[model samples]
Target: MSLLRLDGVEKTVRIPDAEPLTILRGIELDVAAGERVSVVGRSGSGKSTLLNILGLLDAPTGGSFAFDGVPVERLRGRARDRTRGASVGFVFQQFNLLSGRTALENVMTPLLYASGRAFWRRRALAAEMLDRVGLGHRLDSRPEVLSGGEQQRVAIARALVRGPRLILADEPTGALDVDTGATVIDLLEEVAAENGAALVVITHDPAVAARSASRYRLDAGRLRPDEPGVAESDEVAA
Candidate 1:
């Protein structure tokens, strides 16, 4: 069975006076365990909206979505929150690390909400994740002191510390230099594969998208297989 499936998923937002705005239209997708999927789109193509839906941060207004054989719409309240917290991870363009906290602490924040051993051993798990990301020596360094790439690595460590089954990255390399971004993407792919997690990368960089086994283009709120050589012609936003 697919790890996650979206069939004819649609998302529409209502405005006060204007007609409803549809961000996603008939989005059909399926991602299997340990798969790497990349989505490339221009600005306003609903990539972020799709990512939000896939990560369980938002609901679709139409069609259906299922994660691990369970219908997402059927989960309610804390059950939904707990399921999302335990099964999904997110890495954003800004890194989103706590400014005043050390790398270890930033990574440990998620585990605090986990029950049983994960809560008690949050420190060790966070440390191990940081080490896996090659930041073992910088565990005590704060986000302000870390470089952009290091900060992103810390964010990746935090996202993966819980061993989530799905990883959603939203323009994760947008803020870094080309070489640094390449390194970070490589690390992200490697770690996700190691953990046997499904990775969905929403990016503007063709180089990043090309690395994934499955590539798609999101245009005018529609998703389709990426066309050959189209990445060079498309004007994607950073």
Candidate 2:
């Protein structure tokens, strides 16, 4: 079964004294276990909205979304939170690390809400993940003291510490240099593959999008299979 399925999903938001604005129009996607998919879009093309829906942070206003064969609408309140917390991991552009926390502590934050062994061994798991990301020595370093690449590595380790089933990365390399960005993407893909987790990367960079096995372009609230040369042209234009 597909780990995630979205059929004709739509999202609309109401504005004061104005017509409802639609952000996503009929987004159709399916991600199998351990698959890698990329969505390329310019800023304000609803990429964030799509990522939110995929990550279970927001609901689609119409159509259907199922995660692991269960309808999203059916998972409500605590169930929804629990399911998301257990199954989905997010790596964002900003890294989003707590300023005061060390790399190990930042990674351990997710496991604090976990149950049993994960919660009990959060420290070890976090340290192990940091090591996996080649930051074993930096575990004691805070975000402010780390380089952009190191900070992003910490974010990635934190996101994957609980062994989530789906990894959602939104412009994860946006703040890094080209070489660093490439390295980060490699690490993300490697870790996701090791965990047998589906990876969904959302980015405007053609180089990043090219790394995925399946690629789609999000434009004006619609999604379509990426056409040959389209991404290159878009990058040139940008």
Candidate 3:
């Protein structure tokens, strides 16, 4: 079985005074272990919406979601939370690390929620994660003190500490320059490959998506395969 599966997913949202609008419609996809998939689309193309649903951050109005062979479309409360924490790690476009927390501390946050290990006892593990992400020397550096790429690396380290089977990254390289973004991408590819984990990156840049094994585009709430510069797959194949 694939590490993660989405079968006919759908999501609808209601604006304050407007009628309910469909953000996602019939999104069916799968991500296998060690596979790197990138989703690219314009701002309103439902890329973020689909990622949120896949990460279990938001519920789908229709269709089913299964993670690691566990049926989670209808799961609620502890069951859903448990599945999310145990199977998925999410990295947002913005480095969501606390400004006051050091790199090691940020990496430790997931472990605190996951391993149930004491805060002090998990320091070594956090440090190891930082090292793995190429931030060994910056272990004690706070987010504010670190560069944009460093902060993103810290966010990545935290995501990795959970040892999650799947990662949902939303514009992970959005905030950095080309050189820094390339380094960050390399880091993500390295660790995830070593761990045999699946990674899904949401982005708008074809250059970024082209680096992935598979790329999909969301356009007007429709999902289609992406082929490099061409937004549509047919253009590249023919």
Q: What lDDT score belongs to each candidate, Candidate 1 first?
A: 0.91, 0.92, 0.82
Q: Give candidate 1's total backbone clashes.
A: 0
The clash count for each model shown is: 0, 0, 0
- By TM-score, the better pick of 2 and 3 is 2
Q: What TM-score does each of the candidates earn?
A: 0.95, 0.96, 0.91
lDDT of 1 by residue, 160-188 (tens): 99999999999999999999999888888
Ranking by lDDT: 2, 1, 3
Overall local distance difference test of candidate 1: 0.91
Question: In candidate 2, which residue ranges exceed 4 Å CA deviation?
Answer: 231-238
Ranking by TM-score: 2, 1, 3
Model 3 residue 58 lDDT score: 86
After the best TM-score superposition of candidate 2, give how far the Cα of residue 74 lies from its true spot, in angstroms.
0.4
Query: How well is each residue in 1-238 modelled by candidate 3, as lDDT tens digits?
Result: 7877888888888779888888777887888888999998877778877887788888888888787777775688988887787778888779899878888888888777664554456788889889988899998898989988888989988888878888888999899999999888888888888888899999977788888988888876667787555643221100
Provide the global lDDT of candidate 3 against the true structure. Answer: 0.82
